[model samples]
Target: MIKVTDALNRFLFENTPVRGNAVNLSNTFQLALNKQNLPLGLKRALGELMAASALLTATLKMNGSLVLQIQGKGILKLLVVECNSEFGVRATAKYKGEIRDDQTLFDLIEHGQFVITLDPKDGGQTYQGIVPIEGNSISAILENYMLRSEQIDTKIWLSCDGNSAAGMLLQKLPETMNQSTKTDDAIVHDLDAWNRIGHLADTITDEEMLNLPIETLLHRLFHEEDVRLFEASNTKFFCSCTRNSVANMLRMLGNEEISSILEEQGKIDVNCDFCNTHYSFDKIDAAQLMVSDVAAQSSKEIH
Candidate 1:
């Protein structure tokens, strides 16, 4: 097996209006899990989404974050993965009941909604597109979204084997790809290339994807084509959970309740759902938090 690093590699077909990305996460996958003892089914599902999120984030090249989520009514309540501009990623899932190893992601979900959110870091309005989950695999569901919502022809392949997560994405560049005018033959040729490349990518196997390096994998798939591979960007585990955010959450529980808990336990502890980091506040820290919260609210009311 190849040494699969946590990175995203972009590529472009030299003569066709097509582009792609390949990503494999090993260390990132383990970090994303944060040592959570999860069922095999849910663990694999979350890993796949984490890989998919990295590909999509690279596609948009957005600054803030891109969130891919599935909300369902079955045993798997919610699964979400967020990837930021720097290729940092994190994922978490909420599920109950026994998720057997034999059951797949789709088998554990029911009447799920697939949501893609693009949140800009520059205080821009977040954009979300929601659609009913219609595919059995994460690849198919995201491809459907790209085709339906963006009208872009996209193909994605994702795989995870509890140890690592890997995926590849190919998109047929739309007409607005360039300002240069093209003749009808040029348009036809581009379409032909897109079809051929997609077919080649379809031949990838899960073992190859999870174990092969990105460039080697691409070479095997597109050996005859003129493909340019770009430098890879690292994908690492990152969680935005902070002490201040946890403090605000404690404030939401109300001062009375907070005091009651503190009086009983001598401290308050909060754990982030995304990453299993613990935020602990003893009496003094809790009291100061309450004092600031009250002062901020009072200032707001006065204004």
Candidate 2:
């Protein structure tokens, strides 16, 4: 029997300009999907996005979060997934109309836009990129974006079956040539190695990706190549929503808006889309928010 883990593994080829990451999201995927009442196709798409988000976040060298979003005008309205530098991930989807089991990616999202955002945790500036949706699969869409926008040669393989989501990413880094010691033959050799390894990774099957362990999969693909795999990093589902965050949002709405809602519905109920957690603010709670704000402002003025 093979042991499976929800972890991301990074590997590099010796003396080659190729690097890759493999992720298996068994437990994390299920956890993310626990409260979602999504259709089969949409659920699978969200899972793939979760896996891809993890793979992309692992490739970056930043202490921030990476968000992947797809918005469409068809039955599927939105699909969003976020992954931070620490390998934490969460995903959610919004859709209208009936979703058939046989729906394809294009069928679900007709006029879609793909958006990527990089948000730093330390109050740094955020960067965002948008591109018209292309291709039918998430892998093809992201591969196109990486090659066209970032100028990096990338290949991604993603698979999800509602139970498990897994993915592998292979990237060919830019070759750095030492003008003094580099030879034309060395550059040629590097290109050849990249092509060889990329083709080997392409031969991976969905079964192998979702079932095989990272070590077995790597060895199976690059048995003849010198591969160095780093320590495994755990991946899990995490939601950043909290009662304080909700309170802040309510405070922004002001006393008049909150009081109106309190009168009509007796309480304001907010549900987190990612985790489906419910937060309620009653009349007393609403009044207390304004009182606290006034106190804080008065204290600041006195100081």
Candidate 3:
């Protein structure tokens, strides 16, 4: 039976020296797709991006969020999804032209750039990297990104349907050795093994990727090799938007702008593109928020 859960799993291999992760998002995907009418092709693409982002987020050893974004000049104009250490996910996509129901990544998007950003929650430094449209597939672009920018040996496999997305990542750990020995040779050997493993991973099929269970899939890919799998961390689709949050955003625009918007439209309407959640701010509500902000500032000054 198909297990219904949002999980992030980590694994390691023996003798060959590599680590891997498999992330599956079902509940999160359903939550993200709720109340939105998305074309099948677009839905698949978004699901793949969602799974990719969740897998990437799992690799983070620090407390932070990872944003995976794709921008193109073709029918698929933009797609963005983010996953945080807390397993919270949110996503949105925009497109143009004729969206075919059977369109693949290359069919919907001709030319695009993939960008990944790591933002730490603890106010640490953020890391951003950009990759050219290297391959026709999202996984290829991600592998290329790691090689060009991070200079790490990495592999990514992504699959998505309308209601679920799943992905796997395999990375070779940095070499460690004794300075008194021929350690450079060992490092090179490990690098060769990493490449070989990546080649094996390239043989994964779309059907197998999407349908097979995590344990079965790993064994199918690396049965002959020594592989260890870890427990799965759950993921969920969540949007950090609410009436209060929208109110605070209006406060940032200042009272004059809020007043002008209220005067013109009678109410300030803010719609979250990610979740399509709407928030309205009437003149009275805006005024109260402004007053509250002023009062808080005054109290701070008094202290």
| Candidate 2 positional error at 86, Å | 1.2
Task: Give candidate 3 misplaced runs (Cα > 4 Å).
Answer: 1-4, 73-75, 96-98, 105-111, 177-192, 290-303
Per TM-score, the best of the predicted structures is 1
If ranked by TM-score, best first, what sequence of candidates would result? 1, 2, 3
Across 1-303, the per-residue lDDT of candidate 3 in tens digits comes to 465368888887655557788878887898888757778877788898888887777767879889998888888888888888888999888887777787776776666888888999899999988877788778888888888888777889888867678888988776551121334555456556677777778898877776777788888888876677778788888887888888888888887788788888998889887889988777788889879888978999999
Q: What is the lDDT of candidate 3?
A: 0.80
Report RMSD (Å) for each prediction in the order shown: 2.4, 3.2, 4.0
- Clash pairs, candidate 3, are none
How high is the CA lDDT of each candidate model?
0.88, 0.89, 0.80
TM-score per model over all chains: 0.92, 0.91, 0.85
Ranking by lDDT: 2, 1, 3
Among these predictions, the greatest lDDT belongs to: 2
> Which pairs, if any, clash in model 1?
none
Clashes of each: 0, 0, 0
